[model samples]
Target chain A: MKNNNKKKIKIPKGSNILEGSRAVALTVANIEPDVVSAYPITPQTHIVEDLAKFKADGKASYEYVRAESEFAAASIVVGASATGVRTYSATSSQGLLLMTEVIFNMAGLRLPIVLTIANRGVSSPITIWNDHQDAMTVRDAGWLMFFAENHQEAVAQHLLAYKLAETLNIPAMVNIDGFILTHSYEPVIIPTKAQIKKYLPKYSPTKGSYLNPKEPMTMGSFARPAYYQEIRQSLQDDLSNSIDLIEKEYKKLQKTLGKDIATKDSSALIEYYGKKKAKTVIVAMGSVVGTIKEVVDENKEVAVLKLKVIRPFPYKQIIKNLKNAKKIIVIEKAISLGNVGPMASELKSALQGKTPAKIYSIIAGLGGRDITKKKINKIININSQDTNKAIFIS
Target chain B: MKEIRVHGRGGQGVVTASEIIAISAFKDGFFSQAFPSFGVERTGAPIEAFARIDTNFIRTREQIYNPDIVIILDASLLGSEAVKSGVNNNTKILINTTLNPQEIIKKYPNLKNKQNSLLTIDATGIALKILGKNLANTVILGALAKQTEIITLKGLKQAISEKFSEKNQEIVKKNLKAVSIAYDK
Candidate 1:
């Protein structure tokens, strides 16, 4: 196994065919998690099942739990973390919604649990495809949300997320493109077990207050209205400050690997392809990012700012990156219900109080709607003002 | 800057094939990169995967245009519009079909001017015959090795042996035979 890694760089080496679910399992197992729990849901089920297999195979040591519901799953990880042990769990649209109550609790208590929101469309009519409403429903749960641009990012972010969560003492939620990145196959360069172990300093919880007879302590107690606000404010402060911790962990990863992660460092302001002198730029994230790059290349002078870090929102970077653009289009995979795409609204925040450029809203790929490179090129072709009104289902 | 396109549907092992092919090139002492296009479509949906192999680290992160070679695992994708997205003067198309290489090239005039190293192997047919399933990956891969001469025959065999199951080893042997048959035909 040692010298097998030394083979040439260009020739394709061996590959273990894996779905998105398998990719998640292998990453968690490599992290050597202390606790694993999650409720089975489509697309999300394979992740937990693979984790259980890892536990049974004794390939990794951990207490794997088949929780009754997503709520219990989140609470279980929180409880495990308060005991000063690293823990993890995952869920899809409905299941993630069910865990929203405890999700806030996990953050308030500063438990470092990493969970997956396979980003499914939450519905009254019932759809299992892809959307961000499931995660957007709990966007304010005080948990750090990171959307994966692809399965490789989904896998890479897990390792980084665990380290970040542990560093900041805050839980992390990774939202993957449901059936898109989850079910699809991709060439992911998984860190070796030893490499992962070396890069990730084993998670050590600094704060430990357990609810038990021997060391009995109240984790969440009833507080007066005034005190509640103070605690919530502190929680908010901790989460916002966690942005630093997130970057710190990512920087450490870059030092060890040499390539900077888009989610960390100066890679925050999205990306563009084609001629740098282009007057138009479109910004987006996730797997569709590959499409944008392709379109920009085919139609020169088109650039894109691909957002890898969505939590901190990188306002200054967004403004500076697109200052010269004639038209800035913000495309989104998940719509904001009544308004436009998530990126569209974010573009508004980044552009406010500044010399404004023509900003457009292109909403598409909600519930896994197909957004092709051709469609993106078409969007760029549309007149400058057409962007003011939201373009849905592109 | 050589581009290689891989054609297949979801669950057919095209992603794995590209990866294995890329890694095999890397093992043979060349620079390589492989990634899936990861379309939003579901299982059985048409998909495209790509790889760049050279004597040095790849710089371009864009899709293959003016590909040096195109590997089609499922010949059925010939009907899809994406098939014509980037066929040019120098493109070499290796499709897995029973039809003659010249005949398939004749039908798609865009690819006619270029060399159609079309390996008319019913790889899907061979995979079903040997694996008892529709995994055209191994069969298509064997054809890729023989046609491209980019990697050694032993290297391709070793790569497949590393990935396939015990039962599929026999399937691999049949697939290799199918590839040899495709190469000669």
Candidate 2:
């Protein structure tokens, strides 16, 4: 009977075909967060729905909370984490924007929650498509942010998110390009339960931070002007300090799950591909990185720098990788309204005095507009050294 | 890498058909990726889904600008602009219609002079006869497997069973039969 039961529940060892959302949901199940709460939104809907179905089918051992709104969903996880247990939630686009107030609160409260942002464009004319605008909106919310380039990385990053979040006692959000990564079906190898358990153990919060009736401690209390600045400074310092630990934990995960399962880099913060001496280097994040990689392979003179981690910025790493390039092109999906592309602005700021390479900001694929290979090829051929304006590539 | 684009109406399992192709390719020991075109979907509205199969890992996530093969699940979408968008002279087209290839060429003259390979099968009739419904997505895949050597019928059967495994065993049986019947045609 034991052998039969084990055989029935055994997961496939190598890569299995799975929809991206289903893969993420299965990873979340393996992590076995104490509570899972979310409000359904496009692209993100499949993930939470699968989690709920898993709970209903008795495949998962977590509290699945159905919330009325994204605010309520974010709040539910915030409240759940206050009791010192792992919690998770997911949302996209407008749904994420609705959780804005609580999102800031979750970070300030320093709850180690894991949230998945199926990245999408914010509404103007209204769209339910893949973009980075949604996650870019929360770049300053004090949460550790990571973007995945493909389904395999998406699955591995979720495991890494819980580890990073719990260790730093800071919330983490993994950004997956909505509909692009969320809706795509690909061959991905989800790590086994034993592997994930060995990599990311149960969450153990600090004794004094959580709320307990017996040892009653105050959390999220009001701070006067005297201490508020110091509190903000500490959060900033800790986030920037996590740069080293992120790489360390990623290497340990690679060793635990085998290097083939996770990405090859010792530092999962950024992935660099193509020739070391390539004159042209393209920098981007999210699913677009995959497309760039394909293009980079065809064009031998170009390279790609995939930004996996957004917050804490990875300033030194970006400079180290792009220092020798003659031209650095930053193609992105979102902008700061009046300012340049979110990532482009950061690159300009990071590489201002360090490197002599000119940075070009090109925006494409907003509101799910297709960034075809032709468009990327054209962007690559742009010999113009103009770095002043953001070029909207059609 | 081989890219395929599928065109059909909403609720016609267009996405599911692409996913099946991807899964079948995976079962055949190849890397595959499939995704739906980002759109505001509604019942009976035109929609598109894409799949790519390769001996190595598929890295690109962009929409398929030029497809190697095109599958149409509904005959009504045969000559639609969306159907003709990415197709080129080299594209092999499979359609779910009762019309023969000559009849199809008569209706759409542009497909006549091109080097495109056009294959037509009554997938809807097969599906309706076997499954008692107009769900021609899986049925058309059988024709796809017959025409193009991209994926095998055995892989398609396995993919069908795995996809519908969560549902009634009867559904899995009927879908497999529908695909098999369409394959024989």
RMSD of 2: 4.8
lDDT of 2 at A303: 96
- Give the clash count for model 2: 0
Worst 10-residue stretch by lDDT in candidate 2 chain B? B108-117
- Residue pairs with clashing backbones, model 2: none
lDDT (10s digit) by residue, model 2, range A1-394: 0122232332234879898899999999989999999999997999999999999999988999999999999999999999999999999999999999998988888899999998888888888888889999999999999999888898889988999989998899999988898889987888878889999987887687899989988889999999999998888889989999999899898888986578666578898899996889999988988888888888999999989999879999999999999999999999888877989999999999988888889999998888877788999877665687788997
User: For candidate 1, lDDT tens digit of each residue in A1-394?
Assistant: 0124455443234333346777788888888888888888865877888889878877879999888888888888877877778888989988988888898788888778898877788777787877676876776778777777766677768877787777776788887877666765444556667877777878754443444567667777898987999988887887776656666667777677444222233442244455664688888776677667767767877888877666656666678778888788878766677777767887887787674577888777776556766678778876745555778744
* lDDT (tens digit, per residue) of candidate 1 on B84-176: 677765666777777776877677655555543454567777767766787777677666676676655566666566545345566667656
For candidate 1, the docking band is incorrect
Candidate 2 Cα errors over 4 Å, as ranges: A1-13, A383-386, B114-116
* Whole-model Cα lDDT of every candidate shown, in order: 0.70, 0.88
Candidate 1 lDDT at A259 equals 47
- Assess the local accuracy of residue B185 in candidate 1 as a C-alpha lDDT between 0 and 100: 42
